[model samples]
Target chain A: MLNIKNLHVKLEDEDKQILKGVDLTVPAGEVHAIMGPNGSGKSTLSYVLSGRDGYEVTEGEASLYDHDLLDMEPEERAAAGLFLAFQYPVEIPGVGNLTFLRTAVNAQRKARGEEELSSGEFLKLVREKAKTLQIDAEMLKRPVNVGFSGGEKKRNEILQMAMLEPKMCILDETDSGLDVDAMRLVAEGVNALRSPERSFLVITHYQRLLDHIKPDVVHIMSNGRIIKTGGPELALEVEKNGYGDLLAEVG
Target chain B: MADTAVLAAQTVAAKARPAGTALAARLAELDLPTGGFTRAARADAAARLEAMGLPGARDEYWRYTDPAPFNAPTADALAYTDRESTLFGGIDRLKLVFVDGRFDASASDALEGEGLEITTLAAADAAGDHWAADLYGKLEASGQKPVKRPFAVLNTLAAVDGVLIRVTGKVSRPVHVMYRRVALDADVTVHHVVRLEEGSELTLLETGGIGARSNVAMEVELGREARFHHIASKRADDAKVGIGHVFARVGEGALFKSFTLSVNGSMMRNEGVIEIVGDDAVAHIAAAVLGDGGEGRFHHDDTVFITHAAERCESRQVYKKVLKNGAHGIFQGKILVKPGAQKTDGYQISQGLLLDEGSQFLAKPELEIYADDVKCSHGSTTGALDETAMFYLRSRGVPKEQAVVLLVLSFLADALDEIEDDRLRGDILTRLDEWLTSRASA
Candidate 1:
């Protein structure tokens, strides 16, 4: 469902490169986890896929379901069923969380030429989805991510994912700042939404998240390139040992 | 100090002989009602206005916004209110309507209700011994020492239609005064006075433009343990120029809260002066202004002065301005603590959102404290929209215009929070949304 080939990305405001000749792909009905050390350009890969600004894609080919993703804006990508759960969800004061979710859901629906949900329908859907993430009514009423705990923020991200129901989901460091119990809950939310029509590209530095949300394939990235690709057992090997052994082998 | 007081008294006394100006001449020529206490007050105020004349560009206070519109001949009435946006919908309240600056008695509801009494100013020549007589111009006169506000005096002198409301008990419903200009070239002036007795409460709401060139004043007095809430909205048309002044005083243990919303107008100047005269009094004055640049470069100004004269009193001034294109906004807020006014708590904040490169905001926040034990803080800020927040919203599939509107409303949420009534606050917010929507299209 997602494809990337020889992606060369550079910082727009600087002369430095972030992703150099990187390539990876994850088909439908599968979860791919990319393991990398700090400064290995894992986060940059996720950002470029989501169409974030300030990254100059000098040369690349990225697509979703045979559509040219690199040619679309961020919102256009979202309308085309691409969702990115931010590692640090922004705190937006004065914008009610439920209201924001409803706007987003209806906005995508309208963009897709589908019928928009009424207020009543939206509220019911949000409540039902929030129940699974332990998000109370009060949380839905407050400003988005304002005064939210770390785990609660992650759970909110999952709730948005469920409501939007994007075909291609990119979880950028979803395990960051999450405890064991919180990680388990998030993984459960992700696992429940997994189906043949949906795919996930989970980026993380640790194997703990992969333990909960099991990936079908594992890739190790270093020096701006995906240097190794293997089965899920590669993640366990990296967990037992560190990326040091894998990097040495690649060298 | 004595020299200053003598000079002020002499100036007030010298108002008997007037200086020359076209505005003063026109005011003098009006066939005004005469031979009463109100008449005497009007004459004295007219003299003061004549002495001050119309402020010009050289005046320090009028440097930012030109008062030429206020000085020129009255403008022809605008036909813009046709199918204009409405406010206070679905709310049952006492409604008063005025047409072309005259009280449309047939269109207005009754003037008397439980615990509230209202009398028309046109009938003041016939009425006797009213309670509003003593406090009508008192606060306005008291606020004249440090800064000069001849506009209030001009409004007092020239206004032909208004009301005096007295509340003795808790008012069940608010009173809304609606102004509609049907006549072309209508130069309207109105002076409203409100007095809330001890332990009483009242809510007053005003909407619509008074005239093309309007001078208006409102005097409010809160007695011991009383509460008064006031909200006025000026959605002036493009060619309109209005100068409005409000003078208020709070008594012992009383609360007075007011908010002003301005959506349009080529030139609109709103001045408010409030004094907390008794211990434990609480007062908050807030405003939200939106200016869409017009041919005249849309100018809006808010000048506010709040004084804590008694021990343990608290006051807050919050003002927010949203300007687009070449719109100009100015804010001048001051908080003063009198001697021996210990434990005074005063907070003032003024913020401006300059939506484009040409839009400009000017703010001057001041605080004067004579009491050593007082706590006073004031701040002012002007900035563009947060780019990060904008991107965050846009990435969520919201259109760029809708995202900007959301951010704008979020910026105004705090000022709107000062409104105590939920339904009224919501109505104003809806009006703000409509204004933003229209401006976005423009």
Candidate 2:
């Protein structure tokens, strides 16, 4: 469902290259794990695909279900079924969490030329989904991520993903600041949303998260390129021996 | 020493001569109303105005705000628009309508109500020795120390119409004063006096400007254990000039709260002076201002001063402004704690959210505490919207314009929170949302 080929990106304000000729794709109904070392351009790929600013696409292309993601604005990309779970969710004071979620849901639906949900319908739907994520009414009423803990933020992101139901999801380091229990809860939430038409690109530095949400493919990215691709066993090998041995073997 | 003293005296006279002449020229262009009970107060204000002269750009408080528009001989005319105003429409209130500063009895409710008495200034003057005679301009005169407000003095002298209200018990309904303009070049002046007796309560609502240029003043007196709430809204009308003043005195255990929402205009200046004289009194003054200069020159100024003279009194001042397209906003706020007034608490905050680089905000916050045990704090900030937050909203499929409006409303929530009534706050929020949505499309 997602495709990238020879993607090269550079900082808009500087000449330094971030993602250089790296490429990987996730087919429908499959979860792909990208295990990378520090500064290996894993997060850059997600940002480029989600159409963030401060990045210039120097070469190559990225697409979601035949739609050119690079040419669309961030909101349009969102409407085109591209979602990125940010590493650090923004804290917006004065905007209630529920209000933000409702606005986003209605906005995306309107962009897709669908009928908007009534307030009652929206409340019922959000309550059902939030029940599974363990988000209470108080959390929904507070300002967006203003005082949320790490686990709550991740769960909130998952709730948004469920609400939008995007076709392709990119999780960039979702397990960085979360405890083991928190990571398991997040994994369960992601697992519940998995379907035949939905695809996931899980970017991580460790294999603990992959243990909960099993992936069909594992790719090791380094120096802005995916140099190795294998089955689920690849994650185990990396966990046993770090990227240093892998880099040596590849070289 | 004698030579220096003579030189200083000559310099002061030399300065007063020019301002006195300018004040005369301005007063010559208008007619001062004459009445029975207000005659003494009017003459006293006129004399004080003549001595103080009209405010000029050179004045300390007028540095950021230009006084030329207010001191001009004739007000600039604006093209009238027929947009219907929905301010306070959802509330059950006693409606008092004014057409170009003249009271329209046909559009107003009956002057008699439970727990309160209302009368026009003209009618009260027709009756000899009215209760309003004691409060007409007393608070205003008392507020003219340590600073000079020539425009408020002029408003007292030349006001052509007004309302006088006295509350004696808990009021169930609010008194709403709606101003409508029918002439393009109408210059209107109005004064309102409100007195709340011991253990009484009242809420006052006001909306719209009187004309192309308006000079308005309100004086409030709160007795012991009384409560008073005031909310005012000025709609978006280009090429309009307004100058308003509110002088209030709070007694023991009394509560006083006032909030204003002002939209686009050519120029506006709102001044508030509040004195907490009795122990355990509370007072709060706040405003939410929005300005866009694309239509015309938009300059808004909010100046406030609060004095705490009794033990354990609390006072707060909150002002927030959002400006874009080269608009300008200014705020000057001060809090004072007198000696022996221990346990006094004062808080002040003023902030400006600029939508673009062209807009500007200027603020001056001051605090003077003569009591060693008093607590006073002040803060001011001016900045653009948070870019990271904007991206977060847009990335969630919200349009850029809609995201901006949401962020702006969030920025203004603090000032709007000062409104103690839920319904009143909701009405103001709805109005602000509508204004922002319409402007985004425009």
Candidate 3:
């Protein structure tokens, strides 16, 4: 469902390259895990796919279902079924969480040539989805992520993913700040949405998240390139003997 | 030494002479009303205006906002766009319509209601004895100290029409003052006086444009334990130049809240001066302004001064402005606590969201506390939209324009929150959304 080939990116304001020529693809219905250390360009690849600013693509191409993701705006990419779960969800003061969710859901639907949901229909749908994520009425009423805890922010991201129901999801370090229980809850939420037509590219620094939502494949990314790809046991090897062993072996 | 002193005196006189001449020239352009109950107040106001001598560019209060537009002798002609007035349409109200600063009795509702007494300023001035006579310009005059507001003085002296409302008990329906301008070059001034007696409650709503160039003044007096709410929305007339002044005196245990929303205007200035004289009183003044200079020269200013003179009084000032395309916004707010006014609580915040680099926001926030036991805090911020927040919204599938509108509304929510009534607040929000949406498409 998602493809990236030789994607090279550099900081727009600086001459330093971030994502060197590196690529990996995740097919439909597959949950792929990307494990890497700091400054490995795993997050950069996700950002490039989601159409974030402050990055210049010097070379290579990334597409979703054969649609050029680089040429589309962030909103357009979102309407094209691309979703990124931010590590640090933005704190938007004054825009209520429910309002943001409703606007986003309706916006994507409208962009995709679908009828907008009425307020009642939206309230009901959101309540049902929020019930599973344990997000209460007060959290939905408050401004988006303004005072949310780290775990709540991650769960809120999952809620957005569920609401949008995108074809391809990119989880960029969603488990970074979450506790064990929170991570399990979030993983459960993600696992529930897994389907034959959906795909996920979970990016993380640790293998703990994979224990909750099992991945079909694991890739060790380092130096802006995926150096190794294997089964779930590859994550176990890395967890047993960190990326230090893998990097040295690959070199 | 003697020569130096003489030079200083000569400099002071040199400055006064031209100011005097300019004030006289501007006064010559006004046809002041004569032989009425307000004649004495008007004459006093004129004397005060002469002493202050139209606010100059170098004046401290006028530094951020030029007073030239309001001081002009003639108003430029502007076509009065004919459209149905839609604001506050769903609310059942006692409608009072004014056209070109003249009260249109035929178009307005009957001036009598339960526990309410309303009259035109002209009629009140004509009568020998009326309760409004005591409050004609008393608050405006009292608010003149510590600062000079010559335009308010000018408005009091040159006002052609206004409404005088006195509420003795709870008023179920709001008094809606709707203004419409028909004359292209109408130079209009209106002075509205509201008096809420002890234990009384009332809501006053004002909307629309008075003229091409307008000066509007409102004096409000809240008696002991009285509650008063005032909300106003300026007509989105791109060519209009309007200055609005509100002077209020809140009494013991009384609650006074006033909020204003301005969507458009070439040059607009709103001044609010409130004095909490009695103990345990509460007062709040807020404004939400949106300006797009692409339409014309949009310069909007909100100047507020709140005085806490009684023990245990509370006051809040909230002003927010959203500007784009080279628009300029100015906020000058001050909180003053007098001696013996212990336990005084005062808060003030003024923020501006500039949508583009060309737009600018200037703010001057001040607090003077003579009482050591007072709690007074003020904050001012001016910045562009948070790019991280913008991306978060857009990435969620909201279009860039829709994201901007959402962010702008979010920036204005605090100011809009000052309106207590849900229906009134909803109406303002709807109007604000409409304004932002139209600009987004444009």
DockQ of 2: 0.71
- Residue-level lDDT of model 1, residues B234-348, one tens digit each, is 8856227888888899999999999988886788889989989999999999999988885455889999999889999999999999998799999989998989999999999
> Per-candidate TM vs. native?
0.93, 0.94, 0.95
Over the stretch B3-89, how does candidate 2's per-residue lDDT look in tens digits?
332233234335555766666667767766665677777767766775787887899999999999999878888876777578889
**Cα deviation of A170, candidate 1, in Å:** 1.5
* Ten contiguous residues with the weakest lDDT in model 3 chain B: B1-10
Per-residue alpha-carbon lDDT of candidate 3 for residues A62-140, written as tens digits (9 for 90 to 100): 9899799999999999999999999899988778899999999999999999999999999999999999999999999
Query: What is each candidate's fraction of native interface contacts (fnat)?
Result: 0.48, 0.66, 0.79
In candidate 3, residue B330 scores what lDDT? 95
TM-score of 3: 0.95
User: Which docking band does candidate 2 fall into?
Assistant: medium
Q: Is candidate 1 or candidate 2 better by TM-score?
A: 2
Most TM-score-accurate candidate: 3
DockQ of each: 0.62, 0.71, 0.74
TM-score of chain B of each: 0.92, 0.94, 0.94
The whole-model lDDT of each prediction reads 0.83, 0.89, 0.89
